[model samples]
Target: MAAFSPELTVIYATIRTLDDQHPQATAVLVGGGRVLAVGSREEMAALAPRAHVLDHRDLILTPGLAEAHIHLVAYGFSLAELNLHGARSVSEVQARVAQRTMNTPPGTWLRGGGFLLSELGLDEYPAAAVLDEVSPHHPVLLFSRDLHLGWANSLALRLAGIRPDTPDPVGGRIVRPLGTLLESASELVTRVMPVPSEADFLAAAKAGVEDLAGRGYVSAHTMAFEEPEAPRALQTLAARGDLPLRIWACLPHERLEQARELGLACSPGSLFQWGGVKFFADGALGSRTAWLHGPGFAGGSGTGMPLDSPDLIRERGAEALRLGLTPVTHAIGDRANTEVLEVYEALRPLADEKGIRLRIEHAQHLRPEDIPRFRGLTASVQPIHLQADGPMIRELLPHRVDTSYAFRSLKAAGAVLAFGSDAPVAPPEYRANFAAALTRRDDEGQPIAPAEALTEEEILWAHTRGPALAAGWEDEGIIRPGARAAFTLWDRIGGNARALVL
Candidate 1:
């Protein structure tokens, strides 16, 4: 164990240890940043007479929450960016962009996201003219809520040299009218945008960590949807002992070789560690890019786009496992999930040999046959997304509606369900996740998959223990002797919660 404060602290509360041997406790003795004992208040007091006592007899204490997936630095920077999450129309989006533009200089770039095309009541891809009308002098780029589609104004398109005839890049597409860039095409504008300084990256990393910590999370698994500097900033924080949340980070598969060259393996023990390699098998549903099976989207929206090939995932995944890293893939559509499962099937033997769990992010839509295939895999899902995606699934994917966001089914299939917010795409609000999972209701108050609803205890486990297991952190996500001392105090399960700062 690493050095920690020598002083002993005993916390008295209604403790849910989540341990079979000692399922309940009234007091916990903590030292060296770990649990030393768990029992009744009198027993703990007798064991550590000189320990400082924290009385919280009315509150419920459980293992600390973990955000199973997030784009940490991007979410931090988004705190200051324009937000269009609830915008219901083109006019509303225009007004928000115009408001931000009026407060900024003419040539500056304005960036933000969180709008759904379906919610905006748009039948086709939105044109650049919609935003150009609001901020003609300034460049603007807004992403779809799923981050799979980019809505760029004429100025921003011109800056990226995207014209009407520009060819779509592999694994991405550029919509007509030169307004929307899908998948890898979004990189066109983003690559040309001004890069943040080292200080800016560090600050954003700090903000994201602090925000989650404040929300009662003791840890997070940051997905690799950010610049390389993002993780570097987090590492700097870890080195300086400024990070409050333990972070398990992923590198884009493109960096796998470089990681191998640097001799980087799964090095745990510190507050921050690299543990997974992230890959996208397909785009997102809201963007109409989910790689679906035959008969695809109901209205001829066609089967979704596939990003990484199965061959690449298989070959590279084997290499990643050899280095002690998990192979994490993003699979949203049934076809995407099917294909990824095929790849994982090939990698399973190697993964088992290495003792690493293969993870699938957003196993949102699935075929009944594929449900059984998820056994022993980590289904890192976001129930909060169900609130917004419910109607979309009904409209575009009616055939798969029964299995969409199938949390209960996934759990019953022996898949470890790790809940998360996919922050920046959505806020990292655990309450939203709890409500969405328990209710199975969408924004329209319609049930997407009522049979998929999970209980509050199950949701709690997904948020805490499930994520810890996915990240291979055996000492976290449970309140027991020899476990991390971090925990969350709740007024009630599925109610207000705050981290117990020890």
Candidate 2:
């Protein structure tokens, strides 16, 4: 019996396969959603005379881009929410809230995010009273860009039953003046808000994937910061054949037992799959909750708050590895990184035995000694964050400046560098990442560890292949025979790019 030949398509372009054996190619023969061959245009055309030709000889082709970190559904929903990304002052934020409130009916919950305290020029935590003046009739809840802190109006506080004397929750805090909530405490207000319906989730999931696809991304790793329904929505999209981008998802560590009970594990080879168990060691630097070493922030902020103790990570991480899922920990501050490293060091044997990599998210601040310890680990980092965090790093963590966003150092130490946007916190703009990683410059135009800057090729590899490796997708993030038939067409590398849809 003869094997049937699937319908074929030949793509002619200047291909950068990133495969050492065939680093360059003039054309690719694709069939059944996989690369059939890669070679010169004449060779491919001769091999598949009947194949459909899609010529793009002038553009550069590479493995499709991957957004390594994001909250997919949340980013989708955030598209319609009030954005405060560049709100420069409290007054500016109030104005935006006021405008949204005027359009929304009274008593409706108003939600938005993307403001940084440093960017807002606030020396103290913002008071709820300021919001009351603009939106007293509506309940307003705005999150800092980091998502670690929440600022609410008085009405929102009342709705959440938060008061000046309301004792903080176990792992969170309520700042004075009855307005700001930190960490778990933010959940108090959020818990009372109306939950989105199934329809809402599905729509958000669709919007997210489409947006990413439009931006030339072929895949993304959705972090676990979202509600469970988020992943469910993505799964629905994949099942319905509406998912435009492949998704590698993470489950919150709290759900590890539930996952184990349900017999869930790392099941790949689909548009969506569970790949990681997410644990947070601390909060973000902008939120002043990044657990740090002694003599914390410049203003006596106190060594920042910690979350998800190291013991829990080691225990749950082992369980996750046992199920063949990578253990991904979010570690930002130097102290957080140190603690996570200690935890990873303990789990290294089990991880090695299972042939799974231990991953660290936001390995933003690190001690020089800890850099080498990341060997064979996955540094799932977001270089775009450097644009906003550079000044904050200098002001809040001057001593650890040398290793902040140490892309070069981590790579040198043998860590697979996976770059992402951390979307909804920052836009998943790869060009911005390219600029930040290449120039090592912050929003203030200051150089932050210039020696840590990476080349354009390095950034491209981190954006594509590194993410694929992290997700255990061996056939993705490259252009070669037997690989997924997905590629990005770029006018120039790191410039304008669009997914080469067949």
**All candidates' lDDT scores?**
0.94, 0.93
Tens digit per residue, CA lDDT, model 2, 1-502 = 2322547898889999989899999999998899988999888877888888889999999999999999999999999999999889888998999899889999999999999999999978998999999998999999999899999999999988998779999889999978889999999999999999999999988888899999999999999999999999999999988888989999999999999999999999998999999999999899899998888888787889999999999999999999989999999988999999999999999999988989999999999999999999999999999999999999989988899999999999999999999989998899999999999999999999999999988999999999999988889999987899888999999999999745
Q: Which stretches of candidate 1 lie over 4 Å from their true place?
A: 1-6
Worst 10 residues of 2 by lDDT: 1-10
**Clash number for candidate 2:** 0
The deviation in Å at residue 483 for candidate 2 is: 0.8
TM-score of 1: 0.98
Winning model by lDDT: 1
TM-scores for candidates 1 onward, in order? 0.98, 0.98
Q: Write out the backbone clash pairs for model 2.
A: none
- Model 1, 1-502: lDDT tens digits are 2322438999999999888788899999998889988999988877888888999999999999999999999999998899999999999999999999889999999999999999999878998998889999999999999999999999999999999999998888999978999999999999999999999999999999999999999999999989999999999999998999999999999999999999999999999999999999999999999999989999888998998999999999999999999999999999999999999999999999999999999999999999999999999999999999988999999999999998999999999999999989999999999999999999999998799899888999999999999999999999888899999999998788899756
